[model samples]
Target: MGGATSIKVEVYGYSFDNTDLVARQLQSGMLKDPAFTQVTLSRDEYTPEFQMNFDRTKLALNGLTSTTAATAFSAAMSGSVASYYREDGDEYKIRVRYAPEFRTSVEDLENILVTNAAGQQIRMKDLGEVVETLVPPTIERKDRERLITVTGIVAQGAALSDAVAAANKVISETQMPTGISTVIAGDYEDQQDMFSDLLVLIVLMIIL
Candidate 1:
């Protein structure tokens, strides 16, 4: 059997920090409300990432630009097209990338070589350092703004409107920080739009 539509409230903010904060608050509020159940946030888990921080002074001294260092790192870890190969009238890209084993650890990344304008090869570690950090698995955006979706299941005896109203009450009671906003979305928003259109049609018919 197919599943029913879910209730999703989208929280938009200029920055991820604010957006995540508001989303968590909304999720907490929904969970406490009797009208909602199974309240959850659509935020993805953060993953470990290694970021390369280039030392500008070292690059300038070594006769290298930031772009040169970044490109070299990217080529080693990700890949870059070296040339093209044509076989049977089909042209294929010849890309070059480090083997998985060679680029697995921070030490491996630091050992990658970078070429400078003077045709001299320098060790990446000498130019920059790799720092460990955490980043989101995926970033979701709407209308060019960062978005975090809060979702919930309405209780058995509660109507969709009741759930929405309860959510709105929670939102109104919470002190929203600057640059953060919320909108009730999903089936409920669509239903409201449909009803508004129907009302407009009915008014037009009565006028005629």
Candidate 2:
């Protein structure tokens, strides 16, 4: 991470496989760096139906339906602009939604209303389920494999190269799980390129 007056070096590892094992190895390397401040490991998983079932059940129990429940929930989260009112040459939208406190919990969500064909108000819980959960973080796929990242933060005045080298050594000594490989990228690649160019320039100067 960098600030207004100086640049700080951070080393990050990108991996497609055996993320858990690599994370542990990276964690160990951070412990050895006096300049190390923290390390983070992250992975992504997908589950579309996890909490959806609860929403469906809640709607069913409340004498409402899924379509109605969905509409109510959406409106509750994002207010709808019914019309625009002009005042002093300026126009403002007339937005409608439940009060913030009213829609703060699962119970509040279940109580949301959806209008039916018969003009009856249906509760969200009547047609769907509502359960609190950690929705899996989004993932981008490359070659049909999940990606994981291990990030390390180095203390001020620490050389990025030293931190990266230490991280690489630790990773190499650790036994990686099958189907996993770690790669150094981002700023590390730029540093490598710069170093290579400098060495070539020095050699050329001597030859001349």
Candidate 3:
């Protein structure tokens, strides 16, 4: 089991791409710093997502909506469970989806078919295009601004305050993108909140 974490660091930015870069850099710097044993990115940076872009005018002409086209495209790529089969004492799901040849590339989406209001088959190509791009698997927002978290694990016998102070130094020395900001969160934030509450309780006890 992992030891109780002593602190957490959150590096914020205007966009995920910029924040991710900084988080990685911060993690590398933290490992090299004497104050921390390891600093790891809270989220993976290079998650690939398929984007299907459609022309609204074209869709309207074909009596199709973006929702309709997206639904059709998702069904084709991920497949739909249509039925089931029973074998021996186990039950199996039988699914229907596009063949590998049709689901292999972005161009394969062009072959997708969706029926319009007219009951006519409309090819995806007629609606728009598709592209593969990097997208964040999970989005984190603080004050409605995007941020990335880089968690720093203090070395055994090292003080948590030293790790936090070292991280703050790194943030100060590191150049950031315009409009980007950073804030400490995770375990560190929780620790601060708990201390504040405890201080209040102590002061109340003395007053009583």
Candidate 4:
């Protein structure tokens, strides 16, 4: 079977200061190859997500904890299933969720009300803050190693070997920083492994 072009670049840093930069550069370089008809990024550069961090002291003062905070969040944003409604032998789930207006903005989250042990209503902002972050929607990891892959499809009539050559060119030419590494995987890596095994088998057969 023919192999698809795949380039794996693993960038490591305390902060992801260079991860996106390197990924964009690699993708741009691979696309310049004439053999590559198209180049696409698996993860977008800017994917937005919210991270809420709670103050332990404030939480304890309000008789709340991380677990309860999570529950409150889930109930607010994702909704909660209160009960099932059955009518004329038909059943439907009843989920109570916040309206779009009430859950769409940072102000809304800050204004969320969580009850205290004293049965007093407390705003979520009094306990924690929401941090906006641009993170990858999905991150693929193998064997606990974080990886970003640059994949290219070979142009029509281009041989699979051409793709492998392009991959090698990028691997050798790219100047990698400290703690970052590269490895070729997918069909190309598997083909190399198979060829090595075939060579051993032929050598043993001749000896026998």
Reference-based TM-score of each model: 0.81, 0.60, 0.69, 0.72
Q: Which tens-of-lDDT digit does each residue in 1-208 have in candidate 4?
A: 1654443434433224455566667678878888777766556566766667899999998888878886887688878999999999999999998898997778888888888677888788889897777775566566776666666777778776787778678767777666666665665666788999999999999999
Write the residue-wise lDDT of candidate 1 on 9-114 in tens digits.
Answer: 8998877777888888888988998887678888887777767899999999999999989998989887999999999999999999999999878999899999
Candidate 3 accuracy as TM-score: 0.69
> Which residue runs of candidate 4 sit more than 4 Å off their true CA positions?
1-20, 44-46, 56-70, 85-93
Report lDDT (Cα) of residue 122, candidate 3: 93
For all predictions, the C-alpha RMSD in Å is 2.9, 6.0, 4.6, 4.1
Model 2's alpha-carbon lDDT is 0.62
Better of 2 and 3 by lDDT: 3
- The lDDT, on a scale of 0 to 1, for candidate 1 is 0.87
- Backbone clashes for every candidate come to 0, 17, 0, 0
Question: Relative to the unseen true structure, what is the C-alpha lDDT of residue 47 in candidate 2, on a scale of 0 to 100?
Answer: 42
- Using TM-score, give the best candidate's number: 1
Q: By lDDT, who's the top model here?
A: 1
lDDT (Cα, 0-100) at 11 in candidate 4: 42
Q: How far out, in Å, is residue 123 in model 2? A: 1.5
Superposed Cα deviation of residue 131, candidate 2 (Å): 2.6
- Quote the lDDT for 15 in model 3: 74
